[model samples]
Target: MFLPPLNPQLGLRRQLKTIVFRIPTRESPQKPAPPMHDPASTWNTLKDILPGTDNTVATRVSENEKRVLNVFGAPHFALLPRPEPHRSPSPYEYFCTVNESASHVEQPRLSVTKLLTDAWCELQTFYDVFAGLPSARSARLSSGTRHHENLEKQAHPRVDARRVEKQIESAAQKHAPEAVEVLFGTPMAAQLASQWSEHVTMRLVEMADTCELREIHVHGFLDLARGSLVTDAAHVRAAVLVNGVVDLVRVDASNHTQREPWLEEGLLLVDLSCAIPRAKATMTALSKDHFVHVYDVKTRQNDTIPAQRSVLDAARRQCMFYSRFLADLARDSNYAYQSWLENGRRRRVEPDAPLGTGNATELLLRHFETLALDYLRLARGTDLGFDDFDNSHTHRQKQNVDGPEHASRYTLSDFVSAAQFREMLAALYGQDSPFLELDVTPLFSAWKRPLTLRYFAARAGQTCNILEAVVPGSVGVEYHNMHTRRLLKRMHFALDGATLTAAVQHAASFWNGTRLPTATDDMKRCVYCLYKNRCPVKNRATEKVGERIYRLCESQDGACENLHGA
Candidate 1:
């Protein structure tokens, strides 16, 4: 028989994982000999013994110092764990605190991303608003930010320094020249001068690459100061805030073969959004025709998916979100849709955006064709970011290599008996050749979570396959509701205004500390959550040690209180 090792220092303070030990004999003492030395001190001594062999501790200390300085130096920087989990303070306390803090100032506007994040994990949304926790500066985030910054810096073409110096001299004769002496005398001044030159060059580049002929000023946001093809400032900020930098917005893209009948009418496309290494959306919106093409440019190897439908459907939802954002802007009172007339200046056209109205369904349906093709060709079965792409040369076709099929394999032993979970599919859908032959259902669920086969119906509500290219009038995939384990009655797209508004309103309620963040049944998300320490949710299992009982965040605790407002 094995027994847990006991240490006087810890006194069972730390959790142990069924450590095995030999039972003491009658003559021996019950307590195991105390550890020879403190684990931490021993590790440090080892490190000292092997100098430079490992600098992890030193490196961590230096990184911490840098991080502290960076946090203190930056304005509006309040660092917190990723997917900030909900914490203490009763609902009354939270609401009272929010009012106490921001009472004088107007509440901040709710962002689309924030809302979507909440939809993904209600608990995360709660922490985002009520907690006032600063977003963590993750490495992925820093890398993406640097990449975008590099691109933006490249916006202004470089010019010969000597040429600029000569121009500066020429300007001195007519106008007061900027301080030239400081450029050479001070490093800060030189850096400033260099920055100013880059700014001036950016304007020159923008001027060189103008795009305002058809829908004058609609070509690009080259010079926002001079005025953009967009109607106003609010819309500009909205795009940047929600989607970051607009990658490329141009009017009338050539390549007629790729263009549809509506292409002849000429189109203004909001081609690409910000380039986050994780998820980069290529949304092409034709405002006038009310047609949009939202492309999912996933590189694979980025996301972790639970169900194939979960992520595939999420992409469509993201696209619709962009469509809605643009539609709202198009319909804004100040927003004047512009058109080129026989006259010199482009005339302001009337708003005819059909994103959420009666014809909204058709327009959204048209966009679905491209999404379906992408699902088949690009994303394969699942849209998990972490899913591996097919390497043409190295990997074999019908290969036994690991992929989403394995990633989505979850253990449902917690919910059902192992025999039932693993054998249920074989009994129910066994006779169905493809479903059974393809191993469509869980044969045996793992102990971690339930494994269930999922199928998603397209907008048309029919069975769909990856091999087919979705056409406007073609039939769709048969509807399947993974949760209900039955057929679905309605479509997710072009949801009426009230439904959409309600969702946003629900998310926005968190600001008032009215809606508490909720824990999802999605165990994988919880496993990856960085804020589990303070999270209210606990796993189903609990361990009682001494006076205190320890519990993990993964428990199926229904009482996972939304500490902000619950």
Candidate 2:
């Protein structure tokens, strides 16, 4: 069983409790504040500008509408046709490596697994550089004054103010027509809103104590206003842990300390706290012979063990599958370069191997060690389908094997069935299962089940449906809505949004403690009223809002439990 941390209070258990505490504290209301009769104050209050109900009023706009295309504030559209079932090329076809005996090759030059590993490693490095300690030393960005001096030293161009203004107005009309009105209506004032929320402040501070690099200069306090939306110490700590695991596995595999790259990669990033209630299942399943030890929190005992084979294999396979699942995200996308860089960086110093090696542990490790070379060959053994194969190495009898497809070897319709997978796996490693005999139905179930568009996009890849582009079909309203909902849920959490967005934008920046920026204008203008500036969110909208709320609650002594501050 997964050993709980030595102190029984230092691992995922403590962290989860902190997350649960992020929810607002509950108390019986003794009295209510007098309704504000002041119009200005009412408008400023979140309760006034919107409906109390959850129903959203936003509707999809026409392409010709004179408004900025803000994804945030857009209405749901049910008009698009449904996306067809995804038709992935056989997994073997895309990611399989060729054998050494092969004389010809047609697959992509690089090993897909290596590419994924490299990308994962770079992501970790980025997190390490910017995450961890808030005050860790690194390159500092120029501040408001320094930026102005640099701008002054730059070359200037003479321009007609009237003409320039006219051009700007024209551009606004063509581009951000909706924003133009909003910009004009508001005063020339803006706020650098923090992303950190109230719930994570204390945890962030605790996490910040462990990092080596630091980017934040502001102090992070649990009671600080609008702190949840801003980056904090806890975020950095989580990123380091995640990236560290991934990087470690890659290092292990490269150095011959581990195998099964895909499994290792997958497990490294799983949200264990949310996935399973306790560490027991993970530890027992992953650890073979080694006993899981919990060291005392105060006393540093070296109890961690060498990476287990089953754990490594499962991790590596899962990671590759995840990457393959997200292949749609990599194609013709801006992140392609970053993906390439990450892939290149993760590789071991050893030579590359081919894809599609037969099912054997020694062979798998050997092949993984020489991935670059093996992948160049694109070898497929003499098997049209995994179904016909038996456990014995030698065929029971010489049957008449005939048909043009069999003769050509070029007709690729090889599919791996469940039985075949089981048989092959049994053959490859000879039945010494390292994982605990826990029900893994859920693991397969999650993947086997049809997924919403957003879930597919968020977890697998942003763009899995290549057919949507080629067929020019619409994502059905129901599917789109489902996808949107799933995606929104994933995005709502601080960890997922921050990490994914940071990965997209800075490839190197680990999203550990970073907060998601404010919703886009469209989201801000959505038909739904929740999460708006005026709503009673767990964390206050702006720093001023928190400070005011704190003061107001504090003044009304004993009226609210939160008067002491949550």
Candidate 3:
């Protein structure tokens, strides 16, 4: 080695072979022969023998062990395939319970309010029905309710004035000698008389030109197809019962101006001057001479005028639905007129009755009868003081002569005679009714009438129309704060049949079990939702985090490698 460092590698290899030759072989007595060297076995043996020398080899071995343990033992990671997620039933299915006794399922009824709520947040509405969540009460809601009550009271004055007039007339006829003295002698009676006169005069004026009806209840089925699709009749009959109360219906005089003062006044006494001027002014056709405009009133907590676009859109759609239903009721040719009333009555009596079982015309007649009775009672001042009356003046005088204790009280039938009540009914609901007819107008003209939505602040004296303030120059936009001298903001919306039809079809899809309830995209709406806490879609952050984790796990398993690479 000192002579020449020649072949240093050969010298080392020779020394290693000499040491191996010294070791025992298979034929030796002390030990078995060494196993034949296999390249794979030799490499694995080296990896185990020199554990700290090669980190890559140790890691690969450790991973293989883990994979084997995961398959056989109680490992930390999941190795089995994931299961499919559980799905919930749709609203229609959830609400439509199966009747064990019968072969059919009970159909679910939908309301315009519910449909509108679904439009705003289908998830929230679903929770409301499914979970039976109590509606949240707030100061704003209370204020709105009070505002509606006030409007109703304002409308009642005309009825009250008629009642006072009837009392005055009765007093004049029964106690002719002391009629004037009795009326003017008492301060209360005199004040009531004066108020009555003023109200009657104002009512007469209002009747001649326009009338405002508040809280008109309306109901009908949602026509999902609108004759657009060729579907089965049974599919079409899937239409659900939709009902709602219209906040206001404004009836304006049409070009046909034939005034029947007697009909307009609705007075017990008919005079020569009250005669109908035109032969066309029959009981059934009066609605044709009017242009009907629908309105919806909304109250907000702040002075913000127009409200968010979502809010305005909802309000517009709600008003349009109300208008459409009302127009349908007013049309003689519409099937709803013949079926709505009976259906309502049947529903009232048998809440779980099958759909499309009752008649609407009969139900309407009942409503008219009730309305007539109410008007007659109010006009006769039964609510005020005229509680007792008779057909003959002598009988009335005899009752008056008797002490108050001995006087016989008149029944509702006696208070307002059947003939008189029927007359009023015919006047209010016959062809001569004050409501406008959609059938008489040009196509879509009735629906096209400008819809006004008025908003009032929770607190008084703060209001503005946000739409008018934001975009003053928009076309077909009329902004006004005329109500209560700027305390209200009114936005006018033009009815769009296409948009309304689309919305109806969309909403109907959910009710018909064709679609799932959709969560609102607007975060602000979620903030106000009563079901936000438990809503599946309210907190997107958690969902997003979970989705990311899922994707990462999938990529690690090589299931989503392409997705990660992309």
* TM-score top scorer: 3
Positional deviation of residue 361's Cα in model 2 after best superposition, in angstroms: 4.7
Cα lDDT of model 3 overall? 0.39
Query: What tens-digit string does per-residue lDDT give for candidate 2 at 81-190?
Result: 11122212211222222223121122122221222322323222221222111212322222322332232223111123344344334434543555445333211111
Once model 2 is optimally superposed onto the true structure by TM-score, how far is the C-alpha of residue 474 displaced, in angstroms? 14
Task: Identify the runs in model 1 with alpha carbons over 4 angstroms from their true place.
Answer: 1-110, 128-131, 146-290, 294-316, 332-499, 539-566
Winner on lDDT between 2 and 3 is 3
Over 1-566, each residue of candidate 1 has an lDDT whose tens digit, in order, gives 45567777877644547678988767844544433423344445444434433333321223332332233252121232222223244222343344334521222222334445444566654544344444457665555455434444454223333443443344234422343231123332232222221222122112212210110011111111221123344344322123211222122223211222211112211111111110111111222222222222221223333244544444444434443443333232123111111000111111111011111111112222112222222223333121122132124234633345433433222223434322433433244422223221231232111111111101101111110121111111223233232433322344245544444455444433444556666656765554432344532211121112112212436422331123
Q: Write the per-residue lDDT of candidate 3 for residues 34-83, one digit (tens) a residue.
A: 44434343445444433432232211223422332333342323221111
> Which candidate do you rate higher for lDDT, 1 or 3?
3
For each predicted model, how many residue pairs clash, with residues at least 3 apart or on different chains? Answer: 23, 67, 18
TM-score order of candidates, best first?
3, 1, 2
